[model samples]
Target: MSTIQFTFAVFLLMTCSSRVHSQICEAGWFGSKCQFQCHCTSPCHSITGQCQGKSTCLKGWFGNACQYRDLAHVSSCNIVLNPRQPFSSWVTDRNDSTCNEDVTLESVALSWSTSVPFTWMRLTLNESVILRSLRVSFTSKTSSNATCIDTKLYLINNKTVDIRCKVIVDTTSVIIEGQGVKSLCSLYINGGRNVALKQNSAQTSTYTSPTVAASASKAVDGNTLGLLSSNTCMRTQSSDTCPNWNVTFDQSQVLTAIHIYNTNDAFPVCSGRCGLQLNKFSLESFNSSGTVFRYQDHSTTFTSLYEVTVAEMASGIPVNGLRLGLNRTNPILMMCEVEAYGECVPGSWGLECKKICADRCSSQCHVETGSCPVCNDFDDRSSCHTGCATGYFGYDCSQPCSQNCQNRECNSTTGLCFSCVDGYLGPDCPENVTENIEDHLLILITGLGVGLGVSCAVIASLLIVIIYLIGRGKQPLKESKPSPDYIQRDSIGTGTMDSHGYQIYVTPVRPYQNVSNTYIKVIGDAEVIQPPDTYINVTTKANDEHDDC
Candidate 1:
């Protein structure tokens, strides 16, 4: 063979080998190969390979000579036909650049209605496969009253879709009016089931259905219904019979489960089954006889033997009453939902009566606890000094003292005062001293003064006696004047005489002798005296004798 022919042959062989290796599957073979199977039934292009016929197109391989398959490319088949309408809009992640290119499918448009306020939308996949996520853009005119817009993604029949709805204004706002949609696979209406309606705030009726009536021919249960029962007599109808079969419970029982079922498959409506008429069904309990618990005013459409509990029941003693009656005026009854069991406890009627009595007494008597201490006969300030007023004493200062106290009043709490009785002194009325305190003090002062005076007198008397005794014990002072018969003599030769009868003498100087300078002489019948140099001489004799010197 020529050299060129040889090279061409080699290249041709290599190309054929590569093409064969790249093919998704060989003829008559199946399963994963270099490319995915398009379920085509015809031949495909050999070079720059593209399939022309529909059958070939279905069989063709488009990626790197069918070495790789991209599932993301499957979105190319989703074509949004009508893209420009007020209520609907189209969305695309990429620009439309390959409209005429047979090899490239790069973009897809999402078509949806903007007028319907729905939170989510779904689309079914071409094949039965699951989709994980989807992207969406909004194009709806915002409502003035609407606060927010929210979008959600849904997988329907294994395809991803978008949904949009208005966000709730507040948490209290009711959303999802009817029973929630059957499954996640279903499309949401207006994005969701939330419907805006005025909340009912009026007080409900107190009517209740008879227990017997409530237990009567339910499409679901044939047995008599018993909820909560107490020993007390059940509430009675006007006929005075215990409302048979009716049950009542406390608020805590509101959330209990109730079982109900319907034989009919037809859904109840507002007029027939969805209206407020079913709310008339009553619950009754003997423990709270005559007291109606609640009156329903809403409609419910449940047909299955289901269970539900009211959410408003509280957690204390059951104050609920139940009865059974129809509000045919509203004409609504389709057995869609029925309640059989609930979590409500029976109440004690006797206890309620006792409580009422206690409350009434507490309000009327206004009596406080604790007794007032007894009052003392005398003024005592210990017990009721601050709590009670004078002259009043009792459990609550509501009573007066029996005996009248003298100059003393009773305290309200202790029936005692701080003052003593009249004509009495000291803390208690111990003494009846007529003297005033001041007068008594004065008397005491007088007694003290008298004691002092007596003490002074005794001292003076003792001094006088002591002086007299001392004088008697000692010699008396010499008489100031000598008797007239006495005589006086002087050493200096001088003499004197007493006035009555005495003689005086004067002598020459004498050694060591006391002498008088002057002397008095009397001539009466008295004796005479003479003075001598060493001796004075004087003599007196009988009538015949004469004195010699």
Candidate 2:
């Protein structure tokens, strides 16, 4: 109980403190004294320094340590169907919602015979795996002969056996295959159907048909041969009974090689007199330098035709005599085979080979004339070139012309000039009338002359009437005279007059007189005399001696 005991107790205490400190600091360590590795709580992880909840991963991150992953990235998985090759492998298994990545499977080879139905391999995914979507490429091998066959797809899950089923060709029905060991399965068929398994045992499995309908036709004829149609060739005649379609290549089209497939027979048709018919076939070729070689009605035949070498048809061509076919009309009656052979004429190469010839002339020759066609003339008489003039427009170039090309001919093609109409000649119709100015002036002068002549004649007639009236004046008859002595007053006024005691007076006039005149006379003793106002006066008096006294 002395120094040794005290030291031992101190050592134990220090060891416990250090262990507790380590547990609190280190993320991977846990427990009261940091003695055991701790399991992470919600959002707190041992691997990732940060945590939010239990077993949850963030976007663009997965697993421990918050490591970046491509789980959330958008992706496209494309599967292409190759007509040359066929595949019988599991295409994809990406139907589970948990599996967000896209998966695709495609069949490269087309099946020729429906008698031997094509079997698509089963696709299986682990029960724990999650998928988002699936895509597939299923190309038909049917040509003019063989028919297409229906294919079935099946999916299995170990966990959910009750929902696992086989998808039928019709896609409307699903057969329960029973759950065995796996669970959570999905199936997708290209150009066929889809089948999905449900989690509940009481629920039924659902079937979904393909979004795109598959072609329901055959691939080959009775001879099992598949005929390849040329994109540039024209069909001369087509027989409904025969499985093959006859196409004629343009005589001006450069002959490359051809591709022929025999669906019924696997053997190649290269060793026969059977090839493309070059009778009356013509072509034009273009070289790498763009030089062109035109050949008319040149004939060619092909002797060697094989499967592997037929791809040479797309290569450069001098393709005069390339042909590959069977002696019979149906070379591909038994098995589908392909034959492609041709060579461009000298100087012809690349995609430009066919376009060069088409630029100069069309594949079909002119009917009746049988001549190579040229661009139609640009004159007004030709319909092809009958367009708007430079300044004029409409069908016949008859319209009110614009001001841009006044008095000028409009280029019929562009309609950019101003041209005058026929009757109304001017820079732009009536705008500029320089040519007719003199004529208009002459018309005005003539009108003025006619007006002056009419005026003079009227004046002359008026003068003649005045002279006749003066000459015919004063042709009077005999007249009687008024008595001189009797005085007569036309009007009376309101004034009085007294002379020599003889007085005459009148009342004031009610209405003023417009005009009045007075005459006065004086008579005295034995004499009668006129008064000083004899012209006209307001008074008149008679002078008598006796009346004056």
Candidate 3:
């Protein structure tokens, strides 16, 4: 007993120590003992070692554990289209075991559109999904006939029927027309897990024989035998009439694509044996609103798969229910499985809900995409991520922040400035104003005094120059009289000479008082040579007097 007690005590201590170690390791480390380390630079969950936060996980690591090195990433949105995931129709009698082609309805067959003549079954889904590719599993049955390929398959969404055979034809599958998104495929269907659904017809020509009825459910049942059940089985009815249904959803679901499964590969003859397998039948959806409206009216010959899932368009309204139509009288409208695809998640929206919605979206967003069709007061138009534009903050981005905030920008929700621009401080950014009138006044006075001094100096200089000029003008010029010998030399007659260093006298100078000075001074020596035919003047005047010569 003593040994057992000691052993138990040791075990308890070991267990407690292990638990503490697991809780004590930092985010980046992981191990049984919390002694091992993870290489991811981002902080991970202590036990799981998964990096988290707004930023993505470190490169070379992925997944919740950050343990994968592969580049493959998983999508959070549900994009695959599976008919067995709890889909409901407006008028279903029994939810048969239709997940595979081998399953069948035991006692009840959900029939629709008999009284109203509309072949459509109001459909609803469990989750909102942007429809991807749809692969309908047809009920499988063996048949010796070869006329089963004549049946046509199609999809009608809210009174609009897509008939582009290239998009989705035959009794199998459909891709949305115009691409992956041609209309708003968002649907609000019943919540939680979906129940199995199968549509029934009111026609009396249904192959009542057990041989024909035994394989009817094989088209929708997921059978491992493949084409054996698909080649001969078809849900048949005598008359192709109205299946008026109003499918209401407990939750909102988005739909973008539709896929129908019929036993097209069946070799059985197409003489009403296969109700869903018909040569010419139309799939239609009834419009609950509006008296006059137009919808998809395109048509084409069907092949094997009728896929209508490739377009980028939006529906005018989020579809509440759909209708099915057949043009031929007493035509068989048989089907094994039906699949609906769309993007109508509550938190998300869009064709596939591929685009994420803004955080501040108030209510329903764009049904075909996750973009916010409407936002809160301060929310952004594209995304409600930011409450308001710059310089505005607080609830709904209604309150104004300080303009002095650095770069004139501030937090979108809070008005506090990271820093002021200039001349302000504190949370409210008060102005840095002060009085400096006294200093400015002193500077102005000094400038005025300097200007006055300069003006006085200029005036004094101008007055002195004026006084000097006036006084000098009053003085008279002093002149000396020429000598009698100089007058005798000048009285001699001047002669004209030609060329070679000789002077020519046009007329001798005659003296006059106050004459203009225009005399040419002679260079070198001057000599008197009397010549005939030359004129000379005898009167002379001094240069000191104003004289002309």
Which candidate number maximizes lDDT?
A: 3
**TM-score to native of every candidate shown:** 0.17, 0.18, 0.28
Candidate lDDT values, in order = 0.28, 0.27, 0.34
Badly placed stretches (over 4 Å) of model 1 are: 1-355, 358-390, 396-408, 425-457, 469-549
Give lDDT tens digits, candidate 1, residues 414-461: 333345455554322345455555566676666556555555665665
Poorest 10 consecutive residues by lDDT, candidate 1: 193-202
lDDT of 2 by residue, 1-549 (tens): 899999999999999987656456344432233222222234343322445554443332322232212111112223223221143222222333332122232222223222111122233444521111122222223222211122111112321111111111112111111121123233322221000001011101111224311111121111123332211111121121122222222222233223333221111332443234322222222323322322232235442222222111222222222212112232222112222222123232211123222322232222111222221112242123445534454223444345534465543422333445443433234444444555666766665565555556656655675566557773331232323321121111112213322232333213211111110000012222222211121122212221221
Cand. 2 TM to true fold: 0.18
Model 3 over residues 108-210: C-alpha lDDT tens digits? 1111111101111112222221122111121112211112111111122222111111111111211111112222222111111111122222232334454
Ranking by TM-score: 3, 2, 1
Let me know the TM-score candidate 3 reaches against the reference structure. 0.28
lDDT for model 1, please.
0.28
Residue runs of model 2 more than 4 Å from their true location after superposition: 1-245, 250-432, 474-549
* 276 Cα displacement, candidate 3 (Å): 10
lDDT score for residue 57 of model 1: 23
